[model samples]
Target chain A: MINNQFLVFVKKEFAHVLRDRKTLLVLFGLPVMQILIFGFALTNEVKNASIVVLDQAKDHQSQRLIGRIGASRYFDIEGAVDDEEAIEQNLRSGKVKMALVIPSGFSYDLAHRNKAGLRIIADASDPNTANTLSNYLSSIIMDEQAELNANVPVPYTIIPEMRMLYNPQLKGVHNFVPGVMALVLMLVCVMMTAISIVREKETGTMEILLVSPFKPLLVILSKAVPYLLLSLVNVGTILLLSVFVLDLPVNGSILLLLAESTMFIITCLSIGLFISVKAQSQQTAMLISLMGMMLPTILFSGFMFPIENMPKPLQAITNIVPSRWYYIIVKSIMIKGLGFQAIWKETAILAGMAVFLTLVSLKNFKIRLE
Target chain B: METVIKTHELTKRYGDFIAANAISLEVYKGEIFGFLGANGAGKTTAMRMLCGLSTPSSGSAEIAGYDIYRQTEQVKKNIGYMSQKFSLYEDLTVMENIRFFGGIYGLGSKDIRLKGQALIKQLGLESEEKKLVGSLPLGWKQKLAFSVAILHSPKIVFLDEPTGGVDPLTRRQFWDLIYEAADRGITIFVTTHYMDEAEYCGRLSIMVDGNVKALDTPSALKEQYHATSMDDVFYELARGAKRSE
Candidate 1:
């Protein structure tokens, strides 16, 4: 026989969520907004970065090299600094990202000895930008050298052929799609469920629900059902956008991906349920979920940072974060095209978390209406 | 005169604070029993225990032929609770709220629809039945809340200050609903701070600082204390009460 009370409770919860405009906005708006922003505004590709040049020689070759570097779209010659202190000041003041120091070398060096040296000082506070800046500058100088030696033959030249696997374009969107999915799922499933349950407590409806014929576990299950469905819909929206708009393909079994997503969503919902049980007010529930879950999910989940590069203690802590395993599972399945065999460990971890959280929340759910 | 509710020294304590001290009382079926108390007088604590919402620290009680401690599920199924805070989902429409409460009580769809329609007509909310409950006036919401609480025809309905924060006219109309439910043999166990509403109960029990200071019919309580009204009787009993909270 069907549970009449469960159906009623679920319907009420659905109505509450659907009718709330703010919740509806967050449920649908946040995922799409995050994807679009990550895709367009937050790309790593540097363009027209301002740099200062200090040419001590001021010779034809030095001027030529500076002109060549400035001609490229990646570098813009902000000014010609005459002194090293001026270049340092410009870099320190954030007026320029890099400073090119052309040494006082005679043109006879490059023309006769076939080698000349230049120095590039970059602000390494933002390591990624510094690295990118150095790489771009080296490529430009090397391009000029290749042109000069076009007619000459090198006896032993080792050309390294590099190929980027999976994401050949190296689009930042591909890097962020899986991470965004994990963050958004955790937000919708964990944070929203927590606030919703605590809201009932704040409004005194939790007491009424406990007093009903429905068991507390069943009540929790009913609250989670709609969010589960909604999170699945969020998954669909993210996937459709990632595939069609962002061009990130799902190479592994689509069914396996969805199954893992469902498991992760359950884990997050259980976490939210546990938070609701511990918190007495909606504000407290929200604070706990956001601080305890969202921050950890974003930081330790390997969403933005590589978990391996982190310190040993931090890496061990990430082992318990559900988002870390979920990110690994989705990335392997979606980007690496790895099947269940390759991701069984992560899947098992997520499932274990789900079961543990469910048990804890069930134990915390008191039937006493207080 | 069957006893629908019977309690013996029902106590609830948190740490050293006694929210509901060792108190005992009873009420017959179909009797409108007024559980009167000042703020934090343990009337709500006692009612919460009876409605199976809270467990007693010690002693025992039987509600509608079921033990409050062991047969909590049965007790829940037999009784209806209307908290003073207005326990209906404000986001839901009037009809949806009615149907939800009705369905939880295991009523069939046809019964929910029929009873829901009848309630809508009786409350003169035919036009507003589809309207969201939050948009309605407070008085109308109170009446609808009470109706929903008794929709399942439980053996006893616990209303904790159901008429709180409403005007006098609305409260009068709300009392009519309580009297109607009591006339249909549903035991009305109500708690209120309004002394005038206490007079409407068939028998009144005034609690002072976790103890039932006086228990008798309204007229008998007044006569016993040589007071003019329930207001005076309440004042005389609560004058010397020592708060434990």
Candidate 2:
């Protein structure tokens, strides 16, 4: 009996969703746009940064150092500056992100004194770029010095060997793909489900449905089923884009990733149901879903901002946002190649939230019209 | 006549304000019971209680031999309801709305298909079955809503101002449909502010300030109040109402 009724109800819901073109676009287009934007355009890696050099020595070593810095893809040599004042002008005008100063007698000091002095200055206005450019330049100089000392043995030269595990190239796509998955799923499931349910109330169809013999829980469940399916489709789209377009592969089990995503979707649907029960109109539901759910999913999920950088009180609040847990789970399974044993706590928390929200919303769902 | 709906002093209250007072009434089988009132006269509140959409704060009521409080599912099964607002899904096609409503009422697929065809044919919407409900005129939508309400052969259909915003010719046609359902032995409990529509009911109840001020046939009400028309009778009862919308 339930099978027939549920099928018919779900079919009606699908018709509602498909007939509206605007909702369809948001459901499918948002994740694709977000993935492409984050993958290629909004990246943390700095490349081809412009820099000015003050080469006072004009010797073989100083010329070689400037050649090495320009040769690297990290910096673009924007002509040489003869004086410290010129370097200061380039830095202040933002014409150069960094400036290099090579002292005189550089090759003689390096060969006889076994030491050379080179000062690197960077514009600290954009701190991240400044820090990254300075580090890149220092690394290039270190490599040149190591090559110079290839034949002569040094007493105590300690070089730290660094290995970037999981993401060897330190690609931004690897980080944002999981974050986007969490964000897109949360927005689509929560906002769409809430609006759909509250829309019935606004249109007066909910009154008719409530008056029918159909159980109220069945009605609410049927509303959520379509969005759940759509959210899963969204997840599939995001994952495919990440793999094919972004070139970010799932390092762990695909089945596990899908399973965890389904859990998160269910949690979001329950939240949507809760909002629908509390909200009286579509506008209220949309506002609550976007402001109440989307903002926290973006801010507290540790995607755009680091949770640790926030105040201690806010860090404690981040624990309650379900996306925070889902973000960690996705990163663990997708990036770290971990299994269920690794993400069991997060999965358990999500499951607990799903069950708890479903119960609360169901309990609060009024069978009788007020 | 067999009693289909019986209420003993049914009352609903919200804190100190009473939305529906101790109003006792009964609706016999196959009778057109007109619930008449002003805007805030509590006509809707009483109908909501009888339809099992709202629980009464005091008194008792029964719908089709089922206790309203305990057997609400059974009560819902035997009744169909249309609210003051347009109740059909605007995005859904005519045939789709019929099938969905029929499906939720536990009708088999074959039954739904047959009933949907008959309903569409009877409403003269054969060419417009594929069009969305919102695209139809207000009169057509109202007629379709009425037809769908009784699709499952429910014992009673409750209409809360089903024809509020429509042309007079359309309202006459709507009343014709109501009369036909009444002839098929389906009890229609309708609420309306139109005095002309009130005169067409077999019996009418006028409410004022949450209390049933008068209950009888329209002719008897007119005679008892010595009024010329149902409008004069309604004004005589409702002019004393303390609440105004």
Candidate 3:
């Protein structure tokens, strides 16, 4: 008999889902957009370089050298500066990635000694780009000289050995498909759960659930079950796409990956339930979920940026983001192929968070009823 | 008499204010008792306490001989309540709403389906079984809500202004259903603002500012106040209560 009520409630839940086209579009459209945007827009690969030139020698020869440097497809001419001080300030302020310092007598010396010196001061704050810059700069110079030497004699050949490490091909899908999956799961699990609970409260339907013969704990469980099921499907869809379309391998055990994702999704769901209990209105629920969960997850969960590079206090705060631990588990299993032995610590942390949040909300529900 | 509901000075206090003033009420096995009061007159609060949905500050209520304090589950099982808001899962259909209440009341699956079918036919909602309750007209929704409220056939059914927004014709139809339920020996304790509805009650209590102003049959209240109808008695009692303040 209770199955009928369950069926009725589930039907109503799905009805609200279908009737609200905008929310439905957001629920499905958002995940697709996140996958595509993260896989393409917020990719791990580097594309265009902005080069600022600080040329003290403004002669026609120096001008010709600058023109050749800008002609290369690798670097775009960001701007030109007069003195080294301006270049230093721009680099320090992160306005430009690489600054070319052409010496005052660059053309005059190249004519006599067949050797011209230039300093490429790249911002090393971003280590990958900084390392790439020196190699790219020398190649650009060599390429220009090679072009000059095509018709005449150039003193020596500069055979630049340029190699990329870690991700040599710079495949866009390598980091991003997994990142998109993490982002979509994080949003769907947390925001959807929180908003659904708050929607019940705002619409005065939650009171009916509370007054029912079911225990408050059962009520919470029932509320969470359908969402958990939906997220599993979403996780499956994401996995299928990444494997089929992007051709990424399931390097880790698929079982371990699914199990870890289920745990993390529950953790996110619990956090959302906690937020719903704290908020009184749908707007408050949404704002708290966005500002409290989404922003921190994007910033500190290693989904968009590296946590290790952040300041100390921020690193400390990142520990509290549930997405941070979940991100670690997903990345380690999906990308690194690390097994449970290495990922268990993060799994335990997420488990603790899920239990803590669910228990606390349950306590609040009973206490309020009392 | 086997009391279906009994309250001893059942009261609820909302910080310095008495929501349900110290007053006692009793209901017999098959009586249809009406509770009348103005808006925010503590009728709904008192009903909520009796249904074990709200806790009284200093007094106690027993539903079907079960003390509300210690045996809430038993009280919940033996009593049914329909809130003034016509509370139901609006996104669900008529069949779905009936099925939900029946299931929560612990009916078996076969019985739930059987009773649901019978109810849809009885309420003239057979054709509207698949229609969402939110999309249905208000009168149809009200009738369906009351049907679901009694789907479990509890010992006592509490209705809090169930016919408030419904039209007069629908209200008459609803009262006919209540009479039939009372005839079948299901005690009905209902609250209403309409004076004409109060006239249909075997007995009633009038509340004003959290206190019972009068308790008797409608004719008795009218005769005592030297008035023509329940409306006059209500106004007279209210004015008297106001003067006492």
Identify the leading candidate in terms of lDDT: 2
Order of quality (DockQ): 2, 1, 3
- Model 2 agreement with the true structure over B13-132: per-residue lDDT tens digits: 999999999989999999999999999999899999988778899999999989899999899999999999999999999999999999999999899999899889888999999999
Query: Second chain only: TM-score per model?
Result: 0.98, 0.99, 0.95
TM-score (0 to 1) for chain A, all models?
0.66, 0.68, 0.65
Model 1, which residues run further than 4 Å from truth?
A42-174, A367-370
Pick by TM-score: 1 or 2, better one: 2
DockQ: which is higher, 1 or 2? 2
Fraction of real interface contacts that model 3 preserves = 0.33
CAPRI band for model 3: acceptable
Cα lDDT tens digits, model 1, A1-370, are 1388789889999999999999899999999999888866544668899999888888887787788988999999998998989977887887688888777863556665666677778776554456557668878877777766787654212121222222233333235778988999999999889998988888877777777776777778889999999999999999998788765678799899999999999999999998988898888988898899889988898877777679999999998899999998998998779999999989888999999988877776764353
Model 2: lDDT of residue A344 = 98
Rank by TM-score, descending?
Answer: 2, 1, 3
TM agreement with the true structure for every prediction: 0.80, 0.82, 0.76
CAPRI-style quality class for the chain A–B interface of candidate 1: acceptable
Residues A191-277 of candidate 3: C-alpha lDDT, one tens digit per residue:
877888888777655655555564566556666777777778878877876677544557788899999989988998898889878
List candidate 3 stretches off by more than 4 Å. Answer: A1-22, A42-174, B240-245
